[model samples]
Target: MTTYSEEMEKLGQVTIFDLLPPSPSNAFSIGDSVRVVITVESDSESYHYLEAYHPIVLKKRGEIIEIQGNQQYLVNFAGELHVMKEHEISF
Candidate 1:
């Protein structure tokens, strides 16, 4: 069976990991614009192609943020960053 780390690695590889950090507050939601282009760690070489099937869109403007260690900083807007779960982002 795939371990949680394995799943998380796959999630990272996809470049669309979850915001299950301290809490959902660290995560962005619908209507919020994307904060950054996070990278998922997958064995696939063509990550972009994989991403194409699952496009990450900014749901809100202030939903997504960058939390490192203990610092929480909101990501600057670059167009519309509507981020959601893999199922939601993916086609």
Candidate 2:
């Protein structure tokens, strides 16, 4: 079986958070309560592979755990963790 590190290597650097500074306009800070505002849908028949926040997390309440620069945020919903864009969530 492929190790997690190897799989990550194959995918290259998925993010460059360390290379960039925190967004000056970040609306929310760590420990802030928020909710996901977007729902994702996929259409396999159209040959389009669209992916975003899961449907289960839509409108669900979560807390900001980390700031990922460029308006991205790491939120904890219950015990589950998900990365969300600034526009995808609201206070």
Candidate 3:
């Protein structure tokens, strides 16, 4: 019989994102116009677990300025730049 440690070792490290389906926003490219879909707190407990986009970015529209890989994007909201994830934005 396999021990709990052995099973955990086999599973390795997994995050919630890994268990969820890929976001359609994953296909977003530079120059795409997108809008922030969710508000995240910079001081939340889950802040470390996910990207923390400022509340100001919530419901704001921006253009994708760069693709940071791993589904992260650098967006230009007016003159300000913020890094966001695919799930945080919509077309």
TM-score of candidate 3 relative to the true fold: 0.53
Model 3 gets an lDDT of 0.73
Lowest-lDDT window of 10 residues in candidate 3?
A: 42-51
| Residue-by-residue lDDT tens digits, candidate 3, 1-91 | 9988668767886657669877555679889999876534534443433345454455458899999967999999877798987777889
List RMSD in Å for every model shown.
Answer: 14.7, 9.9, 9.6
Candidate 2's TM-score: 0.55
Candidate 2 vs 3: which has more TM-score: 2
List, residue by residue over 1-91, the lDDT tens digit for candidate 2: 9988668867884547546766578889999999765543422422122124344465368999999966899999877788888877899
Q: What is the TM-score of each candidate against the true structure?
A: 0.20, 0.55, 0.53
Q: Model 3 clash tally?
A: 0
**lDDT per prediction?**
0.40, 0.72, 0.73
lDDT of 1 by residue, 1-91 (tens): 9988789787764423354444444333333443333345542433454356434332223344443333244333444333234222221
Q: Pairs clashing in candidate 3?
A: none
* Candidate 3, residue 15: lDDT: 55
